[model samples]
Target: MATTDTQPKRLPILTFCAGHMAVDWPHGAFWVLQPPIALAMGLSPSQMGLMVALTAVGATLSLLPAGMLSDHTRRRGPVFAGTFVWVVVGYGLASLAPDFWTLTLMLAIAGMGTSAWHPLATGTLTQTMAGQRARVLGIHAMGGTLAEVFAPLLTGVLLLYLDWREGLALAVIPAAVVGIIFFQARDRLTVETASAARLGDLKEMMQQWTSKTGLALVSMISIYNMAVMSVLAMATLYIVNDLGFSVFWGGVAFSAMILAGAVFQPIMGHLSDTMGRRKIFAISLFAAAPLGFAMPFIGSPWVAIGFLIVMIGAFYGVRSVVLASAVDFAGKREGTTLGLAFTLMDGVGALGAFLGGWAGDFDLAYAFALASGFAMISGTIALGSTLAFPKIQAEPAE
Candidate 1:
């Protein structure tokens, strides 16, 4: 029988982080690729809305099953490594898609790989570093953030010389390599699965998530995620179509947004680990609201990009903190809890993306305003929940 490696090794974590980096590469490119692909297919704004909605459909469908599997399975390395290859295949097929619906279907399949990643990867990390979950999860987030920051910039550069299809095809090669490496290193990275979860435990977990405080936390995660998806989808379109910027600038703008978050993530996570998750999470959402509201009005390319930086920096910075908070509330079934949170997040986000896209068809400003409203409302809910549950203030990760 294989024994668990109780001590965390640097190399294993690095391999894990690389796997995260590889799986997320395609997602990072989504914003930059959407405009050219829409133009190539002659898709209307409504069709673009449909595309965003559909992109999340597969993710929402897969997350819960993946989470349950992760919780029960002893060896997660195979599944974890497989998610990387899954993304490669999805993107490869997407590159060859001949029509709008075909491309949407393939991209949606790719989204599943990313959605499944969070529950398995993050759940294991939370268990491993149960005491310092926010900090470790923050580091894991940086790996994905690095890919998100570079993938679009790289795709933008590729666009100058190659078609979007070729750019997507080229991305598959690196992800495939990472998958193989992860497979080879599976022994080192395998999660020591918790004792087999029972049906009663699962049912109890569901009840906890639906309780009053649990409902408040879920509301914050879902509403905030919806606003994030809407803003990102609309912001990408607004930059390329309304502002008349090249795809390169669109990539730069997207990278700026992610890079800012990357810089703030570790800081936010450390603060939350010491300061408590609720305050940090609520503060970040509140800070982001005004910047998102201000984005549509800015006409200058550089200023608009600057706003993207600060806005996303605030929200995405605390993302892991929010996840860590949910795990704290879960008290058990960390993987399943994360799965439910992500399912709600992506499900609501899909609807918001569709609505934002449709609103963009009439006026891009409407999309921005709508997104701002979401952030504002989310911040209000988070603040209210924190005040109502004062005992939860400064709750420890353990």
Candidate 2:
């Protein structure tokens, strides 16, 4: 039997963070790539919407199963590592897609890989950090923020010299190396193991979800993810095609939104350690709500960039706090709980992606306004959730 390593805790955590950095690039890369691909293929807005929608659906399929495996094994390395292999294959094939649908299908397959990453990583990190889960997850999540910040901008740079297909191939290079490293190092990553998942495992997790706090968190996660993902999926397209910006500027806008979140992630996460998830969670949604309405009106490129930074940053920064709340509510079976929560959050959130596309067809401005409505709704729901379950526990966000 292979035993886990007793190295400095940061070693494995940093290693895993590296893998996240590798995988998340493609997700961010798509924002920049989508507009060019849509124009090149003459794809409709609905088709673009379908691409993101199907990709999200593909991820949803595996999320629950992967979560179950991670929870049962109490080891996230294998699952974490395996996700990138899928990414390599999927992105590699995606670069060669012959048509719009083919490219969409390839990306959808890759979504399965992307979907598997978070729960295992976040769950394992939550378990690993123990008392400091929120703070470190902020650190780990910063890796993804870096990816979101760079991926779009990098892709824009690549496209200046290469075709979209070649650009995608370049993106695959990082995942291949990371996959090999992660596969070799997987077993050594920290996780407290037990028997595999059983029927009772689902049952027990279900019981937790039924609680006021759990249910409320689920709502917050689902609604907020829907809102944010909608923006991510369309921001570049909206910027370039609708707002009349250059590809590089579109990428810049997308990165700005995430950059703000990245900058704030560590700060807010550390604060949440004493502030409590609820206050931080609610404040983020509330603060971010109006930015959605403001999105369509920002015409000046510099102004638009600044607005995106604040809006996306406000919501995106709250992710670690919300996730920490989920982990606390989950107690021990964090991988499983996170899986279920994200499936609900991201799976349902996928529809918003499609809606972003569809709404854009009618009017890009209206689509943004609709996204704003979701944000406002999410803020309201989060506030209501706090009121309903005031005793859920932890430091107050206020």
Candidate 3:
């Protein structure tokens, strides 16, 4: 279990939202640039898949430790701010990579920086803002979703004047500024922990996660992430490579997928608070399943673009809700639980990205279809595990 302040402090939702945006910006920017980078390097789909998978590997390496550190640390500001700087430095160097393998290594390093923020920040958010978990998590998610919505389009516009490397370099500027702000303001981000992170805590967390209910929850979220991550990695390629769109249009397409999430994340978060995480999650997944399955079959780019909007909109907030639910089960170990949840999500998601990339080699449409199937499977898992999820108490009518 983790510690908490006796007198709750005012939630720094906006500050953390900014942090979330800064953390996610590089990730979204790099993802959209993959098609152009691959073309420039004369890389195949499999190699791209490997790069995405390795990036996930980098994230997994840091996520758990960061989460545990958050649980034990008295002041989280330095870690939080430092992770932001880490992202800036990693991605900035990635921009200067001279070769494919070097580029992959740099990107993986950046991935580590990007992923480390989640446990420190999200764990704090969930623990401190426990009562309104869904709503706050939703708002928090909007920050990242906003970055996801904008990064691709911004990178695309930049690509008009600069090469992919320059675009990558340019994207880190805002994050660098944000990182400096976080570091300077580190004192305010303190969370007093009752106990230090220990071997027993780690053993308990591992055992709990490996338990029947824990494994079920983990499997459901992991499968859902597989669908979401694979699509995120493949959609831009589908637009640029298969749809005959320019890199700018690929940016447009990728940004469009996340646009609704920025608007709907908080709303869905509120609904999840009042309605229930499991129900809303299942609805979102079920709704997205068909849309994703049908995307590859759509011949017109315009229609496919529309489908992307609706499908992704339905998928919006699902991750936030999932995170909130996992925290609900954490008792006092919110940070450790988040670390485990995120690790499972990205680790399994790595496999999906790898396999999806291979499928893209044959046909991007096939990857999209496969992602749809994963969504369906995940939704079914959610629906079946009513007993596994914590029961929600709907908020009173306002």
Candidate 4:
């Protein structure tokens, strides 16, 4: 295993963690306000859905390239720098948008920023704590979950006190600070940890998709992402438009779900680290399916809110378990493998978001059912793949 003997103490990990946290904040904040933002901008629900889709588009486009770049450079500086700048620019553009076209372009740029972060960050985390990949990834992933939990609540509060533009502008500050930390920690990043694998090497990796465990993990990721995106993008709309809830209550519902997930993610990750990824992965998915299916049936607003909390919590908790399985299957080339799987899964999931919006427009209950079906698909994939994958044990640091 490669080592970063000369790297600074803990600053690199701390800074990278902060950057991860900051990137997801805007996503959470924006989604909570999406319905109102669409109304305020005079856009249709489908058009608003497209805006959310565009971010995934940006992320999907960048995933493979970011992984390749991280492998070649072994340094996270460039990735973090690009992500921070593009996110800030994207938010600024979103703030200044005069029409849907401008907003679309802005989101596309922001999507690029969002896209750049994961592969590089995941790669860095894997490298930084080589042997303890699952635990570290869990810790890193928690940062994003934390942001998801807070962004909607903060955005709602800011919107209550100030305008959307002010709220968006305020959102950029954290990214800027994250950027500074990334730059300061540049010296601590080890270039060798970035695999010297060329594009040709990645091509060879693509050929290894014959591995049943790898394929299964990827399949599970796809189903899970589809379910997650569908819910995140459309839940607020359902609450606001169909259930007769105010935007504030809608935001609260979104926040509650995220908070539930945020609380459980680290615990799930830790369990995956200790109890075996497959066991936890299967349990989470199986539990989440019923919770998801039941979401739209509860008529009382508070009951619906409570159900969402349980549903999203189970969804994100299982997500960590599934992602850890990727590392388990990838073994040596965790970055490339993780990146490729995520890109494909999330790309397909983006389509799920579109379907969700369409479903919500017709019937919110149907949309919830659709998400539940995907969760069931994910659960099945996890159960079928468990026996095929090797048991993963954390490696001792070199």
Candidate 5:
């Protein structure tokens, strides 16, 4: 009989990471590409804004179910399978969509795919890496940041040569390929181990939520999401409509912000490991709050671009630290804890998005200012909570 090598495989991890990056690419691409779609479909600003809102709403609604499935099954196959089908079919349908209503439905389908990836991928990484959870998660999140950088630039180039429909349709090819790769890797993803008892996962997650550390981290996530989403959803519009920049250049500005995020996330993750969470966490949040408030004060387009880079860098850098803190507080129930924390925070962030959109309707500067205000409140909460929790040493890598 042939003996199978006992050595662990890295291909599965690579496949999972690449699949995530592929799907996220379109998240940023959609924002840059939406204007062209709106023009083609004759959608009003309110209608377009509602479409963006639905994307978040759909993702938010799906998180709980997705988390439960990943935890109970301890299998990522179904999650990967579901995400792949939806991305391909959803975007394919979007390409052929005849009107706004159909496009909305298609986007909601795509949102389900996007929603499924997070809990499952994060859970798998948490289990696989064991003691090295923070570093691994940081690496995984870097994929998202990198996608944010590439998506708009790629989509902008595609839009120049093709219409929006065809450009969207082209996304289907990569989705199909990744789906196949995920299926092949499914057997390799068998759960290596779990940190906590399955029966107590929910109770444990709930208990953590009440802890000062958990509450602080959750609050930090909420504020970070609000600030990030407000800028992400509106930055393209602000550049084109308010700053008198071309769509191409607007995409360039957005890419610059994500580029900064990509560089800083890993640095913050390393800091979280070496420097201690409380100090780094407090400094990042406090620094980001003021930068967020200063966003509207920039006078020229170039200055505005610089402000975006600084603001997004600080915002995303702190977010990386906050997520690492969640792993620290969650103890053995990292997956379930992360799911619950993300669900609560994202749910609140969804409300923030609606508020931002409404505020933007009145005035763009006013909307951003509202986001800044929320960030300040969240930073204050995080500062206090950090003092209450006990410091824990970083776990060793498996």
Candidate 6:
């Protein structure tokens, strides 16, 4: 946990963005790789479901303890570097996995590493300059979105030339290289820590999230995440199998979605600050519902790509705004709020993978319909909460 009173330097933000791009390189590939791995290993759809769910669940279960430990510890430099190292190790081990179970385990380990990233990075950025929270977070979110574009394109290319396991080894190299660089530049990136990152603050964390506004927003975010993650777990497979496209086309479609987010996330983040966050969030959810519902039926890959672009760009693009909203809700508990938000959103989101896989076992249309419905419900909840609360910043008591 780092701290600051004034505006933060740009180097640290760039460094975090670089690290984000590197780590998510492998993470973004996971979705693209799933279908091929399932085909090769003869896995059932539900078992395929376990791959993403367990990875997220592992991340979710481990987050609280890590979040607690990070709170009490003052040395964030090592924590940041260690996260990259953890990812490198996870991917390295994954490259050597002899079976599906081993591969899943390694991916889960990687998920744990990915889990620490947002809480550490977002907490620091949000604390650094209160005035620029949404924009900074948007830039940070953009880094992951860029990875979303690059990873599949790279992975899709790699699969044509190398063994899949060996291709996974490629992810380890860049991540480890970035980790070493971060270790060397750790001082420049460090921020001051607050006591809230304490090792025994479970009660405090619960108190912040238990309020009416908090519960409503969290529920909306959770359901929204479920819809997004479900699409992530299955979209590539749908494009490749249902639409009769090549693996490369699947990657292209996935990349299109991410590219849209990369381009629009910052703009939306900035917009959320000026417009009401609840309004932006609600609009995003509502706009995406119909797009998600129509994606599976589009038939043409190019047309389907348009659907994903709109959904990922317009619908799922509220990531930073929602995060800023959560920060507004947190007030003094920035670290605790970010950690809990990350954990709960992801933990609940993991269920979407399971549900998506289950539904996809039958028809992808069912999965898409489920996604559309969830999106509408999420938007509805956000709108109702906005009307009920009427205040964007529910600052906790001092």
Q: lDDT per prediction? A: 0.79, 0.77, 0.81, 0.72, 0.68, 0.77
Question: TM-score of the candidate numbered 4?
Answer: 0.90
Clashing pairs in 1: none
Comparing 1 with 6 on TM-score, the higher-scoring candidate is 1
The window of 10 residues in a row where model 2 has the poorest summed lDDT is 1-10
Candidate 6: give the clashing pairs. 2-191, 2-192, 3-191, 3-192, 71-197
Give lDDT tens digits, candidate 6, residues 245-313.
Answer: 777778878898888878878888888888778788888878778987876577676777677778767
lDDT of 1 by residue, 164-210 (tens): 89988887776899989888877666565667867877788878878
Q: Return the lDDT, model 1, position 40.
A: 92
Clashing pairs in 3: none
How do the predictions measure up, each by TM-score? Answer: 0.94, 0.92, 0.94, 0.90, 0.87, 0.93
Pairs in clash, predicted candidate 5: none
Q: RMSD for each model, in Å, please?
A: 2.2, 2.4, 3.2, 3.3, 3.4, 3.1
What candidate 6 gets wrong by more than 4 Å, as runs, is 1-7, 65-73, 196-200, 394-398
RMSD of 3: 3.2
Candidate 3, residue 337: lDDT: 81
Q: Model 2: clashing residue pairs?
A: 275-396, 276-395
lDDT of 4 by residue, 54-156 (tens): 6676667777778777667755566677788888888877888888778777766776677678878887677556656667776777778777777877787
Which lDDT tens digits does candidate 2 get at residues 332-388? Answer: 777787788778767888888888888878766555566667777777776787677
267: Cα error in model 3, Å: 2.1
**How do the residues 1-398 of candidate 5 rate in per-residue lDDT, one tens digit apiece?**
22232112443666667887776766767877776886788754455666776667766666656665665664556667778787787777877878888787777777677767777777767765755565677778777777778777777778778887877777566668878877777655655443434556677677767776656677777776776666666667667677887677777888888888878877777776776765666676567666557766867778777877777777676655666666676665555656665665556666666666666676555556666777677767666765565554342221
lDDT of 6 at 388: 90
